[model samples]
Target: MSDVTTPKRGRPGYDQAAILEIAVLAFNEYGYDATSMGVLASRLTLSKAAIYHHFSSKEELLQLALDHALGGLEGLLLEPGAATGAAIDRLAHVLRGAVHVLADRLPYVTLLLRVRGNTDVERQALTRRRAFDRAVATLVTAARDEGSLRADIDPAVVTRLLFGMVNSIAEWYRPTGPTDAAHLANDVLAVALNGLRTPA
Candidate 1:
């Protein structure tokens, strides 16, 4: 037997994606401005130097987290269903996709939603978010033109209302919750496109 027993190996090292997930959770819990690299290191049980090995600075981590959230939303626009269907159907498909992205990427989406244009990274995220909103509004305009959506509401206003409903999910949605994304998407479409009052 050796004079001393071999020490057990420590936890596996974290990769960029794993670090990003932790960073998003920390940022979500303590707002990006309030979080620091030291705080993140403590949360991750790694030294500041170790974290620096992966990310140059806290801002870099913020950017990567925003990219994760924005990528999901941007990818939704490129899907075939979003581009080829009837305008109303496309609009519904996009809304459904948005809901799924929100639920699946809840922490990152929540962080993205909370950004206030205070920093360069945040401003860029906001710009991307607004662009996505505008794209959805275009679908609303198309749907209205097809007489499938209510013309009484301006497409811009409809776009805002639709997203307002969807974005509110970040406040209360949970991945482990009873409701899944598909059911939530259907509920959203029913209320948004079909309205609340029963047809007489």
Candidate 2:
């Protein structure tokens, strides 16, 4: 009788989650337009068939990554700390939470920040990003109304500037290499809000 071997019980050493993680890195390092399923397969040591089995297309990966990053931030806005504090206090807490998300979800948010709306997937993401920024800007407006934020500048202008600094963290930030996001946030806000002031 000829010896025969049957296939393993299940797909081993690779799954949807693992594929997503690799995809996130790949997307971040090489912009989405340049990354291909074949390249991903080569990196993962899996066949094109295996990758197709997990995600239908690159767009799915983009959407899923955005969901992972934005989901955390969206949830942070609704927390009791955000809902029940002085406007400036709540805004600061929400901003701190945002810095954490930006650091921890660096890859996803990086992709999010670079999107230019060239494709349906990108346009959808851009829409969501605008909505999120608008909501956060509303909070800044509230803080200004409460006399906590500087009255010299427009709340909308300050909102964009503040978030521009926060969002730029993804570009050059190395979470393990040095300065954590919280300390960075404090320092940036200090220079921004205090403007070279020493303790009185």
Highest-scoring model, TM-score:
1
lDDT tens digits, residue span 1-200, model 2: 11111223346677676687778889888878889999999998999899999789988878887777777677777889888888887787778888888887777778788889988878887887788788788888888889988778787888899888888788789879679878877876675555658978
- What global local distance difference test value does model 1 have? 0.86
Please give, for residues 77-157, the per-residue lDDT of candidate 1 as tens digits.
999999897999899889999999899888888998888999888999999999999999999999999999777888998
Highest lDDT: give the candidate number: 1
Structural similarity to truth (TM-score) of each candidate? 0.91, 0.87
Candidate 2 local distance difference test against the native:
0.78
Please give the RMSD to the true structure for each candidate, in Å: 8.2, 8.3
Worst 10 residues of 1 by lDDT: 1-10
Quote the positional error of residue 187 for candidate 1 in Å.
0.7
